[model samples]
Target: MQAESVGIVAGMALVLKFGRGDAARCRFAISPLQETMSALLVLKDPGRHGWYLPWLRDVEPVVAGLDLGLLGLAVPSNGHGPDFLWPSPTSPLTRIEDDLAQVRATDPAVVAAELAEQARRLDRHTVPGDLYRALTGDPVAARETLVAQQRTAWRALVEPLWDRMRGLLDADITTRARQLADGGLEGLFADLHRRATWKNDELHLTGFRDGTVDLRGRGLILVPTAFGWPNLGIGPTDNTSATSPALVYPMLGTARLWEPATQSPAIVRLLGSGRASVLTETFIPSTTRSLAQRVDLAPATVSEHLAVLRAAGLVTAKRRGREVLYGQTPLSAALLNLDRF
Candidate 1:
């Protein structure tokens, strides 16, 4: 799926008007496929997605030989790809396989129409002649080819790092859920994005195609994306469609997602280098084994350091099954000057 861009008008906003029952229906969702699709945008313009430079560098060799022509065409530079590639996820835990299946099952007619629309929207020079012909010649075959490419791309680019990415996305959902609990919709939308403002039971999203979407009680789905930083995306730009509208916004702390935790010199001086390294690795929750792998220490040694840190009130541990996950405490965050967002 390509990153779809709406026409931007200065000070213009897309207003989503909600009816009485919409608030009860609003919900949050996590889509692995959505992240995978958004990651493609990062690859296309690495300069704009500097937060993912580390990840892009790591995956460079893995994706070098992959046949990504169709994928590249799908995510044109203009950012108007077919919406069918991103079917509204049915649940919060929607899997990549499920999302791919939905894409495969898309009607060939819809596929053809969307592809034609995309070709019309994009520069003629950008769409290769042969590829466009093949896609237009047999829409069914084109869809299959696209699905196969998507699977290959997912395996090469996303599967290995999905665990860490999912953790960040899940953490964002937890934070958003708490905001909803503590301050209701107002507080939740208050800081969702600089351009998003909630007023009069309407969500005003600036810099998007000027339009008003009436949510006749169907509500909205808020999707938190790890790859979609510095921009907001709305789904089914056509307001007449029955599908529940969705807003894909960048999650907090994405800047730290691919960053290696650096041991603070002050903490190293205070707690010794080894213990300081262990504590820094807990900036994101990690098991002793993972922490050891990250810090290049033996698991037993990392476990010992974790024990000391826990005793010192600098780290906290929670058991998930047999493995205990260690995380930095607020005290440690203050000492390191790390923002928890």
Candidate 2:
């Protein structure tokens, strides 16, 4: 029997839209578990996860030495495979040890069920039989393998960039929290994904499977990721069971993640080196002090450049409480895009 693809190559993509039942149950969270698992996905198929290709290339040498074991096998390189391996909605604050412990504690029944589901959704010979048995039979050992592999991935792939990644993820969460506070859940989902839409008590997502999820009070957990860009993932397939279904998608500020450490010559030519550096760093909203630290310029100097950029309409400023954050406008995006070509 052939298994269905998870949808990257398949004519159809995995769809995860929502309905009225999900409205009241929706909440936001950040999951270390999902981010770690996603890091593996980015590594496995750089093309599928190509949005992060530049970052992947930068860390390739670092991760080349780690033993990923069954991790890569679990999620096929083509981006289609089992869901049980990385079930969504663990916890906003789940630590590495805690997440690994949860994997170790999976009930045999759940494992069996998930295995059966995987068998139906994956190519028959894609996963080696021994690894499958290890995952489902001696599940305890499999959990240990999962934990060890994740730790290796963390040390190699995640730790080096944890500070920047954490900052981006936290900022996203804070922004979404503010959105929720201002306009409620509907407002929060407004800018979530271009493909995702909330309307008439239903959330519609395009470019993927057409299905409706009945929240039934379990609610939807919104998770933002630094690497889960260019695609949206909805999970815990059987939402009827325990563990809330979460829509894990890319955060808003990913374009800035790949910014070169040094200023771009093309941009430098246009704005001069100092203003160009400020322009590049401001792709993601940043406070004057943060931009100063990132570019190693004084706050006063960064503020002056920001004022000029804002005056020229290349950047815009918004007040978030006590501080004014500067971000790139369409003009800035155009400038960066031009540099890429």
**lDDT tens digits, residue span 1-341, model 2:** 01123443333433444555656667777766667777777776677645587878878777767777566655554433455556555555555667566666777566555555554655658768876666556555655686678777777776665545655775687788889789876797798887677666556655555445566667778888886666677766564766677777788777657665556688888888899988887766777877888888998999999999999999988775566778788988787778568
Candidate 2 local lDDT, residue 328: 81
lDDT of 1 at 311: 95
Collision pairs in model 2 = 18-203, 25-219
Candidate 2: lDDT of 69? 55
Could you report the Cα RMSD, in angstroms, for every candidate shown?
3.7, 6.5
The global C-alpha lDDT for each of the candidates, from Candidate 1 onward, is 0.79, 0.68
Deviating ranges (above 4 Å) for candidate 2: 1-24, 49-51, 78-81, 89-92, 119-133, 207-210, 261-341
What is the Cα-based lDDT of residue 274 in candidate 2?
90
Clashing pairs in 1: none
lDDT of model 1 at residue 285? 70
